[model samples]
Target: MGAEQIRRWESGALAHAVSDPFGQGPLPWLRGSENYFDDTGQVVPWYADPALARSTDGGTRTADDVHRQIKGFISTGAAAPGEAVDFHITVDPPQQFSVDIYRIGHYGGDGAAQITTSPRLSGIVQPPPLTADRTVSCHHWWQSWRLQIPSYWSIGAYVAVLTTVDGYRSHIPFTVRDDQSADLLLVLPDITWQAYNLYPEDGRTGASLYHAWDEQGCLLGEEDAAVTVSFDRPYAGAGLPLHVGHAYDFIRWAERYGYDIAYADTRDLHAGRVDPARYRGLVFPGHDEYWSVPMRRTVERARDGGTSLVFLSANTMYWQVSLSPSPSGVPDRLLTCRKRRGPGKPALWREIDRPEQQLLGIQYAGRVLDPHPLVVRNAEHWLWEATGAGEGDELDGLVAGEADRYFPRTPLPEHESRILLAHSPYPDSEGVKRHQETSVYRAPSGAIVFSSGTFAWSPALDRPGHVDPRIQRATANLLDRICKRD
Candidate 1:
């Protein structure tokens, strides 16, 4: 009758050769939509829980749930040397989906091995039009993967794809395994702080306002318009980890450019939780100040094992968290071994509980209120040096705000740390002669770290050309370097 809707645009289409064998077509939707896209530039949407099931309605996945999901996926089936598996999906509209890929810690606390599985997609996604609309029938593929065991991974699992728009979703999971594989792991808890319950205004008046996990969490997308809120609860991830701020933007940014989000939370690294030996590399996003002993051990182990650690946050391993679980749900307390501050100018992480500051080459010091963006003391540095990213190295421009400042250690990030960019805060044009420690450093073990004294910096995934391309780019590069390592 009519053309295969997918050929509407690329009419000079080829024969329905039973297979996109050539990867051809105007494709179904506007974009050359596919069930999977882990290509160099496509961003793999990370999830707070990659094991989310389609059985629940936006089911709440806790750290335990995520941990189980991880373990389950890894010790699964094995793929042939050069063989790969794929699935097909169908969706409706007004819905967007996210597929997360991650590895489960294979052992107990402190010495876990990264259990690799097939790279099967997680999260909700759209089904093929052929299946959804009954247009043709079902979407064809090789296999639908599931963990064959719980502690013996022979391949890698990847959240192949996730797509949602309107109210429809298409999700697919797949796998690829070889002698060498770079499976995703929950490396650290560098808080994304992207979600919060904005309602019950009174209850959350001073409850540490975090970034909304999504621009669309409520029926009424905007935060203000939403009636109730969903805070204090375990607000999971979007199958995508962000560097510092808004994740979706970075998701889009990574889609446009290139970056891989290797993330983890305190819960994922706790006592019977994640093992650190599984991964060949590790990553710490910006403002990953809140960490637990387990999380710390994981990163440190990765570094000690010669696995590169990319520390892309202004402050790294400053605080520690504990996984206090609850059957009623995850409202576990997040205690800062270091001092914790609240709503105020220069929100500082007091030194009340910090014994690890020395390790990061920084100690909790002072606070700065809504300060103004001032010139970094060394704008001519390499991060901004036109030749390199000196001036804007770690921070492209001035931090400009009353941020809680810290009395940083002289040889920050460590003598073994390679410094990248540096900047300071100021009052007037003369630039208050104080330095606010904004620099990028790499440890001797090839562990790269970046720091910004404040905690409001978000990556530029969505805002690529924003003022601080350095924050995002530097972070991306650091992660890339880690990912590229052996």
Candidate 2:
């Protein structure tokens, strides 16, 4: 096994190594390398061991660089349906490796097109260590995995392995036959079920001006808001750590943006319920703070299989969930809770509580960005133009709206710049200003996104502030970007 999707070896190739705003930078000096991509679109450098390798974009990519470019497993041949395939491996043992496999859509496919996955693909116990020459010393033994390959409905996904231990890194890749089983994976809860679909059962609170739903999305409520009109109708509630009017605003904005969406029932997926791929992307809408291992694994496989992701969320990959069935088949009847043992270690299992900033360029401070609306001054910032809005030159008018001052996320990172979309602060007066602020991330995956904080643009559309022409055009532009193919 080797470092695969989202995993980065410490390939020392950055222009510089900067400290994190909150956490410590990775230990072990990053190694050096010259970029030379293999046939599979994977970049292979001379060094197998790298202490500073990072995902080209804002993700955790090892030397393998699986996040930006999925590496290939086979050479000298292609895979076809119903064929017998052999997956060969050369490892630097002492460093263990394991992989979760998936087969995605065709090369020219749009979004996540994967169709096959080794849902239960066995992983490695150790990966090989790196040698001095920057080459992963191939273990003397030949390890192989067999699958009755499926067509993948497209081309095969190069087997993606996460290095469980440390080892000498290598450029050698592995392959799987086409006849194997792969599921066009769709992640849990958010995959099919939106927060609106969530109904609170403990006689939940009323839908106040603060939120559309009385409760968060993960709860199995009785008043599911699913629609029969279209997937673009209403996506889900605002992400989490609820802000005033956030959920309604998010849905309203989603409808305006024309974001096609759905979610898997918190109760359903927890009951050991799984589905093949349904939606192409498993978006973490907004403010999602909790997580489940099964839920996370499904998403991991989905991404590896080539599903495009829009983690329009903050404070993600944080909690764990379990399936507690009431012996009923209803989605709502299923019981879901934040891992009781707390965080990652479930009552029944040990799970991953991955750091959010590593996966998403921006980190959630457990504190909001600004208590008051602030003017965005990063005029030359690239994100302002990510949705083609160009730079936010209109900040003068926005700031002129009698806004309070703004706050910063301590020391922000330079590699991933941050831009303000909207903000709010406790006014000097009794007036509590609520403005939706959003930011955009032009991810390394080429996914153009708008992370709106003042999500009310959608809900506000029909109201006075909602009718801001600047808001309308800007939001519409972002929606179009989201729905557009390629």
Candidate 3:
């Protein structure tokens, strides 16, 4: 059926002809007051309706029971307006299920808007994944359902909620991108998400780039991990990628302030479909750890072309990976990373003499076992203006997860000026004291590159109970400068 049939819009109102799993009732169309002009004078819909934030029913499944309930993945990481995307799903015990699509944004602090709902479709237990060369690929080859993206949908991050008749639910996230240019471009880290996915997780068939199951049904370390991974399988738990929340946090915060931003998948960059130089700034809002040659080249070229770049998390552009077609010849569907150089080649950017610090102004330090205070430095800088933060002021629990730091011995980017914003010390896994630094620098092209150096930065901007006004204001100052809104 067409999008109109599945979307089920009637008389300009959302038609809830299907069952309401969310119990949210009929959602209203975009109102006049909810529409605002972006920085580019384009009409953008504001999604701040408080009702949109109502929580969904059914708790997410833990790792142990992840696939026991229901799970699925999209044919592509993203799709454009009027494009057709396929959904491959598997429901244990063979039952009925429905798919509810929601656009993620700053919906009145509710964080999402129900775009549409699918009529219940029959579900079944798809066959197990095919394992070849240590790679577990679910060619799923199951009966598929197609969803055509409505032409009127806005460009942003979206998630499809899958619910069975018995109340079990899971999520499948994808981006809706367009050809229009905006002041800022937000790139989702889907490649890294696939890199860490250990689908099936049944202790007998799953394998990602990091770990795998041994012959005795025990988890193996990186040494025995898969050298390649496919996007054809669902995410292991709750069907959500690890570190995805960081991107969602940034989206809610940025759209809440009405910034002119567009969205794209990281693979979009790899294939050269989206040009970074077209926008004023490129924002990587999560733990984007993997990189391909084309992806790195494009961003580097954009930075030198005067387009600003922002890295909100640490350990970005760390691994060197390449994309190949799936066994069935689907282009760029398989990711390969040996993690070891072959014949004088290298698997990491640093090993090849082109370290990430030369571009980010900082490099990955180590993992943080516990959250620590983010000690402030250079409070007088424009990025920290109006935050009321001064030298040595510590933002509690602001420096957690993986972090990045400046290395004086490594190659640094050429810039007109450089400043260290935060210099905090924390104990590493070995009890050794190490320092983390947040930095910004102005390149010769007049482009500004800012790295938060901590995974906590994005969460602090929007996550409930984690939001800090100092961080919110400081981030606004930086984006305002980049988008020229200031």
Candidate 4:
């Protein structure tokens, strides 16, 4: 088969495997590509509306006429164990419903096994009144159920399985985290997910940062785009909860290997709830394109304090955002940002004199529609230690998506060594071919930061797929030394 044909097959197989949360068998394509790689990374598809059927477009629903007779969302998007959380429900036709909570994580060969289950709480769903935004309000729905998280609950991602009598179901996602420390911190980009959630409430076009409303209904531009998105609504699509394609891949892989890790939302960094000094390293996985002032400052401080970082995805920290409290006074429930509207607004953090290149050792180069070659440079670097990679060796299919490039900015970070590990070329938005770089550097604070500079990094860890063993070993190498440090 031709190269293009091979990539298409591989991409389809990977997508198929990841879209299933109940853990199906591996896709038959590219079998034995890696003898050592395991295929336990399948995740349940997280939909914005679990009641809606998945549309062919991937991000939208298949049946627009389908109305959810019963649906609800959690009072909070995240909470700690022993904390009582309320699940507000709205049942159409006045029916009975029940909820079962499950903690999502890797359990052996299957992806995302329901590690824990809570006692089902039954209730009657009532109609909810529309809010000022024309969306459903939890207030009128006096029919709500509560669940006190068990102290034994692990720190990670969770989903509440909401089922109505006679077999209708939906899911509500939340994070279970606390003020603990670990060898590594995995920050989930929940903000990015909420920003893109076009939950079709009130029958207008789906509302999200990328869309706006019109006289005819919802349109696909920023003209009527919501500058502020609330976490109060349910996510649309297969509910492949956000970051499943991006960050969750790494989480699954890391768990398979038993990495010493802790999970938290990126908001924790912005709110100063995370102590970076407690961990040897912080990992930003796939499409981490937004940041707040305090979040950036905290990481910079952590770097100076000897904590390392790894950016396993591209186009990171490209925009700046501000967080506000929800009606409940829960901090970070509302994320605010006005993109492409100019200065005085929350412009790209780079426009505010803080380019991400200064921190990432690379800049947002652009994205790729076609595949690119990941050419190894200076393979002698310790990162290429075990898998036997060499200078100028091309690792196929490793830089096929969004990519970054090395561009030293003013006020450069104090680094002892900066090395380009891989150079991948692809066409930019203008159709002009350009190369992206993956780099590693060490700061004077004894902190080392590695940038994969491509969105393909995490996917390279899955198997019977497009994974490269060399890349996996290289990743393990970085984690080993970083975690071993004092």
Best candidate according to TM-score: 3
Q: Model 2 TM-score?
A: 0.36
RMSD of each: 15.7, 23.7, 10.6, 7.8
lDDT of 2 by residue, 329-435 (tens): 31322223333422444422223335433334333323232222324434344333343333334332232211211124333212233345544332333344434
Error of 2 at 153 (Å): 30
lDDT of each: 0.33, 0.31, 0.79, 0.67
lDDT for each residue of candidate 1 in 366-472, tens digit (9 for 90 to 100): 33333434334455533443324444334333343212233533333343644424445444334355545544455566654444544334333233223255455
Q: What's model 1's TM-score?
A: 0.45
Instruction: Report residue 387 deviation for candidate 2 (angstroms).
Output: 8.9
Q: Is candidate 2 or candidate 3 better by lDDT?
A: 3
Which RMSD does model 1 reach against the true structure? Answer: 15.7
Estimate candidate 3's alpha-carbon lDDT, on a 0 to 1 scale.
Answer: 0.79
List where candidate 2 sits over 4 angstroms from the true fold: 1-287, 304-306, 311-317, 327-353, 367-371, 377-445, 448-450, 453-475
TM-score of 4: 0.81
Positional deviation of residue 62's Cα in model 3 after best superposition, in angstroms: 6.9
Clashes of each: 101, 82, 4, 14
Q: Tens-digit lDDT track for model 4 on 1-486?
A: 222122211222233232222122221111333342323332223322222212223222111102545566676656788997777765554565556565544566544545444455455645433344422223445537777888998887766666555545566667788877888998888877777655543334345665634544424466556777766655543233444455656776788888888888887888888898889999987668878889999999999899999999888888898888777676777777878764575468777788888898887877766566788988998899987899999888777667888875545567998899998777776889889899899999999999998877877875336578888899999898899831
lDDT: which is higher, 1 or 2?
1
Per-residue lDDT of 345 in model 1 = 27
